[model samples]
Target: AEPDPLITETQGFAQSLGDGVDATPYGLPIEYESDVIRRNVEWLTADTISSINFTPIHALDGTITPQGCAFERHHSGAIDMSKDEYRLMVNGLVGTPLVFTYSDLERFPRENHVYFCECAANTGMEWAGAQLNGAQFTHGMIHNMEYSGVPLRTLLEEAGLPDDLDGKWVYVEGHDASSNGRSIPIEKALDDVLVAFKANGEALRKEHGYPVRLVVPGWEGNMWVKWLRRIEITDGPVESREETSKYTDTLADGTSRKWTWVMDAKSVVTSPSPQAPISHGPGPMVITGLAWSGHGAITRVDVSKDGGKTWETARLAKPGEKMALTRFYLDTVWDGSEMLLQSRAMDETGYVQPTKTQLREVRGENSIYHNNCIQTWHVKENGEAENVEVS
Candidate 1:
C-alpha cells in the first residue's frame, strides 16, 4: 500500500503548541462538538417562552444526560430567582404553617439519587402514527441526573402532619407566572419525592429551575414542578387544571383517565434512527439505545431488526437503577440490507413495553399522554433511517 501522507507527514496540531488550561476558565464542549445541543421544533408550539426543547439524545451516550443539553419545558418561561429570594411554604392540614428560606433547606440533612424525569408527552406525538422523523424528537423529552436535596418527608415531618393519614394528598405549585400546580397522592409525595436544589453536582441551571425544584421520582415530569413554591397537605387531590385538563389521558370513548402519573417502561434505538444514521457501510456494527421505567429498574431490553418478528437481548452497559436511564447495545454485523429497528424494555415489575398496535387498540389513539408504545425506524441500504410504523 502507498504511504498515507496524513500519517507519514507532520500534522499542524502535532507541530504547534496547544492552548493553555486557563484558555477556558469555565469549561465547555470543544468547538468540534458544537452540533450536539438542545433543539426545538417551531411548529410544535406557538412561542419560545411557553414551549419545550429536545435533548440531543442520538448524539449522546451512557445514561446520565448532560445538564447543558438536557431538554427544557416551560409553561411561561424560565425564571431568574436568587437563593436569597427563594422561599418554600408548607401549609394546610398541618399543625403549624411553616415557611423555609433557601438557607433553611440547606441546613436539613441532604441526600442524592439519580432519577429520570420524563414528560408524559414524551412520545405523545406518535400516538396517532409515525409523526416525528427522529428518536430525539419522539423520545427526547426526558433527562436523568443525580439530584441533591432534602426529601419531601423531611419537610413534611417538620410541618407536623395529623396522625390519621388515609386518603391524603399534597398540592405543589411553582413560582413561575403560570404557577403550574399539580396534586400528588400523599403516599407518593412521602415515598421518594425530593426538594432538589442541585443537579449533576452543580447548581441548577436557570432554565432547569435554578434555586430549587421538586423531584417526583417515577412520576410524569409535569408533576415535578420547577421553582417549587408551596406544598399544601389536604384530605383529597386538589384536581388542579394541570391534572384535570392537561395531563389526563383521553380514551376512544372521549372519557378521560385522570391521576395517571407513572411513566411506563419504554425504549428506543437512538443510533441508526433518523438523526443518527449509520455512516459506515455494513460489517461490525453496533446498535445502541436507551431504556427506562418509572415503576422500577429495567430488568432486560430486547432489540428487533425485522420489526418485532424476532428478538435478541441487548447488553446493558451497567446494572439498571430504579427510575433511571439504562444504556443498551447489540454488537453485530450489518449486511447492507434494509432494517426495521425496534427495542422493547421490560422492568422489574414484569411489565413489558407495548407495541403501537397494542397501545392503539386499547387507548384508541384519542389521547396524547403516557404513550409508552414501541417505536420503529426504517433504515435503508444506503445507511439512512426514518421514522416508521409496522404491524
Candidate 2:
C-alpha cells in the first residue's frame, strides 16, 4: 500500500493531530505566534515594576484587543488577588454609604458595551518629535473590548447620591499599592460610567483591574480606576496628585490646563510601519488602522500617502461607535515608490485630527500628554517604514 501524498507532504500542525482536549485547560494562541506579544521597551522607563509595556497593535487588527497582548501601565505594579477578596465601597456625599462584594456586583442589572481605553500618554512621546519607531509604541497604549457590568448610576442610586448635585464629583481609587485615584464630574458619572467586572466576555486580566474597574467612556484612561475599591461622592474635585502633579496639559505660556479628560479624535496607520513592514512587496496593498473620538463617533478618516499633499478617504471597515475603536482600510495598488503615510480622523462633531505642526503651534513642547496629532510613517522603497514628522 502506498502512502497518501497529502499526508506525507504535510508537516508540523498541518500533518499531526493537535494536543488532546484539556491538554491546556485555558487556551492561548499557538506558540508560533510568540512574536505577537506585549513588549516592554526597557529604555522607555526605569523599571518594569512601575512602568509600561507596548501592545503589539501593529500585529493586531480589528476592534477587540486580545487580553494577553494588550498593553499594561503600572504606577506600582500588577497585583495578585482573588474575586473573594474583592470589594467595592460607595460613600462620602451620598445620603447612605454602601458596600458590595464581587457577587453583589452581579446582582444588579448589567449591560455590555464595547469601549476603548487609551492612556492619555498614548502618543505622549511624539510631542517633541518622532521618537518611537513603531505604531505599537506611538499608539499602542489603547485597548477596546466589550465590558459587562452594572451602570454607575444604578450603584450611585444605591448609595443615594445626595440632593445637592450642583457641584459634586466622584473620587475613585484602586486597591493596588499605587491606589491610582482620580476624580470625575458627577454628571458624567450619572451619564455613562460603568463598574465593569468583565471584558470581552471574560473577567478582566489582573493587570487590567481584575475583579472590577471603572469604565469612564469618552474620558482619559486615568479615570478608569482598576481593581476599583472605593468611590466617594465629593463637593469638589479632589485635585489629587494624579490629576495635578500629572495628567494636566501644559500650555506654551507655562499655564497648565487641568481636567482635560476627554481624548480627542485620533487615528493612525498600523500596518506597513516600522515593526510591521510591507513584507509582500509592491503589489496590491491594504493599508488599515484604528480610529476613535472621545467626544463621539468617528465619521470619517483620510489617508495621505504624500505627507498631507494629497488625501484619500479610506473605507471604514464598519460603522464607528461612540468612544470605541473604528477600523478603516484603504485598498490600493502600490507602485513601490517611497511614501509618507498619515491618517486623519474626523469625529461626528466635525473635529478633524490635527497635524503635528498644527498642534505644536498651539500647545508647544512642554506637554507630555494628549498628543493626538495625525501620525506619519515614512515608507521607503524597500517597503520598510519609520516614524517621521511631516512638516
Task: Output the worst ten-in-a-row residue range by lDDT, candidate 2.
Answer: 6-15
TM-score of each: 0.98, 0.96
lDDT of 2 by residue, 1-51 (tens): 999886777677785787799998999898899899888879878899988
TM-score computed on alpha carbons, candidate 2: 0.96
Runs in model 2 with CA error above 4 Å?
Answer: 1-15
RMSD per model, one decimal: 0.9, 2.7
Which lDDT values do the candidates have, in the order given?
A: 0.94, 0.93
TM-score of 1: 0.98
Q: For residues 1-391, could you state the per-residue lDDT of candidate 1 as single tens digits?
A: 9999899999999999999989999899999999999999899899999999998999999988999999999999999999999999999998889999999999999999999999998988898889989888999999999999999999999999878889889999999999999999898988999999999999999989989999999899999999999999999888888999899999999999998999999999999899998999989999999999999999999999999999999999998999999999999899999999999999999999999889888999978999999999999999999999988
Clashing pairs in 1: none
Give candidate 1's whole-model lDDT.
Answer: 0.94
